[model samples]
Target: MNLIPAYPEIFLLIATSAILLIDMFVSDAKRNITYVLSLVALAGAAALSFYSFEAGAVTYTFNNMFVSDPMSHLLKLFTYLGTAITLVYSRQYIVSRGMANGGALGGEFYSLSLFSVLGQMVMISGTSFLSIYLGLELMSLALYALVALRRNDAVSTEAAMKYFILGALSSGFLLYGMSMLYGATGSLDVNAVAKAAVSGTIKPTVLVFGIVFVVAGLAFKLGVVPFHMWVPDVYHGAPTPVTLLLGAAPKLATFAICVRLLVEGLLPLAIDWQQMLTVLAVLSLIIGNVTAIAQSNLKRMLAYSTISHMGFVLLGLLSGVVGQSSNGAVGAYGSALFYSITYVLTTLGSFGVIILLSRSGFEADKLEDLKGLNQRSPWYAFVMLMLMFSLAGVPPMVGFYAKLTVLQAVLNAGQVWLAILAVMASLVGGFYYLRVVKLMYFDAPVDNSPIVASGDLRFTLTLNGIAMLALGIVPGGLMAACETAIGQSIGHALKNLASIAA
Candidate 1:
């Protein structure tokens, strides 16, 4: 009955409400108070999550609907950090775009983002079907509104509608799948579902059907191929700040639910889901990388790049359960986790630079917008160069290590062909990423306007871009953390399975 497991989420919920109320009373000139308070709330939540990690082993609360463990704590901490960084980077951009003009729309942007973070925390800790669904819906609903925050823009409105419709459809698929699983296993608890899956008492055909729908729904959230129809349009249409929010931190929550659903709840069905993920992984890699080469818009290109990167994550996940033995599970899942974290880090800086370059009435979203970036500001251009290199998986950047680890894990799982295909796809994807670097370093200036960013934005982006190289050079700590988290979680799940059997 200890409440420690839910403390961070509880604190975030309260903080979000307080921020919303306080924001309502603040004047337009004092909106910075809301911004600063929101950042403090996120930092506080992160501190709580880190402190809760001292509990060590996995602990369940609310009748086992929510579980807290090292993995959840670490992911939650990063989610807080990611969201905070997004807010900081977006502050000037939001102001310049009139998104923070002391209105309902302005206030909702911050409040909804905090609520979305609350949902992400819930998703990270959720251990039951209902808990996970509630988190997913909360996050999705907030994002839908945020996408359309620019109420006067027709494109923004259209993108929001498309996202809402597709998002609702995906939710229906996920709920139906959950219902099927509940019917087949007679339990909504993830551990109970796993036990039932392993007992050979349920109908395998029905279980596989549910798994397909669940995977499809999860794939849509992750923006993989065949279900990624909303990504480019939304990224293109939303305000840059909103697009940044969409592109970065939510992926952690999505990955969290994927692990909860596929690994914790349905490990016994690994053979089936792994095969399905193989198709998804392959198609995402091929299409994401190939199509990105043709995109002139920076956001659209990054959208495709995100798809390809997620494909690599699937490769890591699918490789974990190769032949029934969970020996490779730690490495496989750890690689995916590491990849996800590094990707978010890189994305924040990438979009931060975009926001910095953008000003009133200018989007700075086109490829040509980056031309002669070096001539305007060599330091920021260097930052952009590192980000592009990292995204392209060039050597000595964190992205390279991230890709290498996943490929190594796939190879360790005897997925040599999959590994090879991943390498080829990365090579293809590198072209578009390097094109950005070339634009910044080689091409002449298009606007010749001196790049201006707030001191906070500059500081955050500089550190973020540099961290890519720093982590790449010394990736052991983060890699070890990922491995430890995954290993402990897997060990805990196995222990629960043993207890259930006894």
Candidate 2:
């Protein structure tokens, strides 16, 4: 099998091992070396991904178990960036918490993060059930370790146990579904499964059942209603940087798997899965929004908020491929992709502010922790204001555009009622986000000390905030890029499938 398409993953694997080895040897005083090396690794991987994308070719390797296309390339690059930013934002927070180096949980945070990213990359490029499951395990295992990093914290240990048990259940669901599909199709390759599905030899009852289990598994990973028991508790209990790691890039990888399994491997079952998604989406929107109003912790609030936002992503996803209209389906799926990326961007920035506000011996997790943030540091407060507004889907913010595009896709699918429901849920969700803004600007300072941060943290956060506004004002570039990427990747897969059938 040609390994050229996997250069990035291979490089990252080597670098992660090296960093882990180096971190073990370096003195605590020189721990910064590990951080720098981790960033350098991510940069190298990102550069490799960029060059792969620039080659303007779709490639499959390892017996076609892994494929590199525009979508994988784009998502992998963002995964690298998101992980790098998480490292930057968490550097101080983890260091302060003694989770960075020479501390209780220090030895593995950065290394684990890199492994998680590596798994995400594998998931993104995965073209077979085997490859996807391998990646999922790698990512999930690392996250499990990270969650329980603070061995002293009972809450953290509890959260890790819950996450691990629930995560294993989800993986079992996925595997069961995949097994059923393989039995029906006699292959694990996604395209081959699609071919078998279309040839009409597979049992209809078996196909539907397989899809049901698969959708169930995807819903859990996405942390939607019904299967989202772990999101809030885990988000609240984990260290903030670990929380960031959990909350961000992994979603993109999950979204990719959804597309791969549902859209690519099981297109014939779209009507069935789409209806299932509709139910999950509506429940997530209503429950996630309403429950978040009762939360006092900022991380838990974002956790429920995450549930609702995922519903919006599902709206875009379920809206695709009505009656085989390729162009319209591309727009619908692209909208979902766009929503996923922007949501991750906003998540990273929001968590960055939390990490920034925190100091040693203090955790800024409570809603009250943000009281009068404007008085302490107006710039970060403003940065935070933008992030909150974006999450709330306010005007001239990237989030509004993300929501609009998804709603547009929903409407295009003749699902006006679903679109209306999403809008209502968004309005309800806006309350908690606005409460955050109110807490920052209207309340008295809880602590008046200035927000001290590393130069990289301050500079990166500024650019991130600006990006929220700039991308909103000029969303065409990013939107077009997403659309093009989806079109090239999915369309190429379709063409290849047609030719194979011929």
Candidate 3:
């Protein structure tokens, strides 16, 4: 087995353990050590993942259970970068709230985040359902504890409970789906399953049933409606930094899993799955957009917005299956991948601002908190405006392109009705997003509300906000890179599946 491809994960594992040990011995005054260590580890991981690209074509090791392909590697690169950014954005928030002070403070959160990153790394590269499941559990288990970190808060406790219970139920759905697919095909490998399904040898009823269960599990993680009950409460209750992490990294990993399972493994059954996901997608669009208009809490509103975005992403996935064009699959997959990256970055930027606005004894989650934001801090207000516009899918912003790419891909797939529905929902969703922009610029401040953030927080918060503009304006380079990654993965997956089938 070639061990070089695994270097990124190995480095993180060792570094995470070291951080944990340091936490046990480090004092509150010296807790900053954990942050420094985490940055080192994350930087190392990022470098390693980048290095793999130059080595040659993507390859799977360990009997093809895990593959280090361009797509997975690219996502991991963003995952590490996003993780590092979150750490930087989180330091002041964590320290101020004593999230870095107590016995479990400083190092513990960083360590768990590193562990979660490791799981995400594994998840993106997984070539088998078994591997993905293990990675999912590792990531989910750490997150459960992270949500409940503020033990004294009843809301935190309840959020943790809801997350844990719902997460377990979803995991069960995923596992059962894997079992049914495995039983029908007698293979645990995704490529093998795809080949089997495509061969038309399996019972139709069993295949459809398994696909439904699997998509349900994926929908839960992606925060789509019907499976999205946990998102708002969790976002509202968890530490703001945790909300940042939750909104950003794991969603990327889940998107990878969805692409791998649906586009790669179930390509042969595309016709059936596409109809099912279309319904789910439309439902998410309607529910997420309509409900968000009524939310007073920023977190809850963003949570619903996430659900709507998931719907858009599903449109891209469904398009890949239905399109007649040869490049349709590649376009859909690339669009979805790019959408996820932008989504994570924008979420980080938005949450970073929330983190800065937040202080001890202030939740900073209500829309009223954003009133008169421009007058208090023009720079922060400007940043928030950019993110809100991006989320609203306005032009020249990354979010617009993200939605456009998917819609284009969906149209290429001939799913014009689904594409139209998405556009309508985007218009409706645009209303709520614009409301935030209006509050920041037009509304008078409620008495006693002011915007304040620490130095490091401010610096990163600005950069995160500007990134949406930068990428949106110069999206060609990133879009090209995304296209290349998805193309390579799909080509290899098809070749491998064909070889196995013959």
Tens digits of lDDT, candidate 3, 376-425:
88888899999999999998889999999999998788778878889999
Residue pair clashes in candidate 2: none
Ten-residue region with minimum lDDT total, candidate 1: 492-501
Off by over 4 Å in 2: 104-107, 492-502
| lDDT of every predicted structure (CA atoms) | 0.90, 0.90, 0.86
User: Which whole-number lDDT from 0 to 100 does residue 184 have in model 2?
Assistant: 85
Query: Candidate 2 lDDT, tens digit per residue, 1-502?
Result: 6989999999999999999998888888887888889999999999999998888688989998999998999899889889989988988777777764455335488899999999999999999999999999999999999999888889899999999999999999999999998888889999898878777777878989989899999999999999999999999998888899999999999999998888888776677899999999999999999999999999999999999999999999898866544447789999999999999999999999988888988888899999999988999999999999999999999999999999999999989999999999999999999999999999999798878888999999999999999989999988987888888878744553344445
TM-scores for all candidates? 0.98, 0.97, 0.96
Q: List RMSD in Å for every model shown.
A: 1.8, 1.9, 2.0
lDDT of 1 by residue, 1-502 (tens): 8897898898889999999999878778777888888988998888888887755678889999999899999999889989999999888877778865633226778899999998888888899999999999999999999998888999999999999999999999899999999999999999889989888888899999999999999999999989999999999999888888888889999999999999999887888999999999999999999999999999999999999999999998998876567778889899999999999999889989889999988989999999999889999999999999999999899999999999999999898999999999999999999999899989988899877789999999999999999999999999999999888776755554445445
Clashing pairs in 1: none
TM-score of candidate 3 on Cα atoms, chains taken together: 0.96
Residue 187's C-alpha lDDT in candidate 2?
A: 95
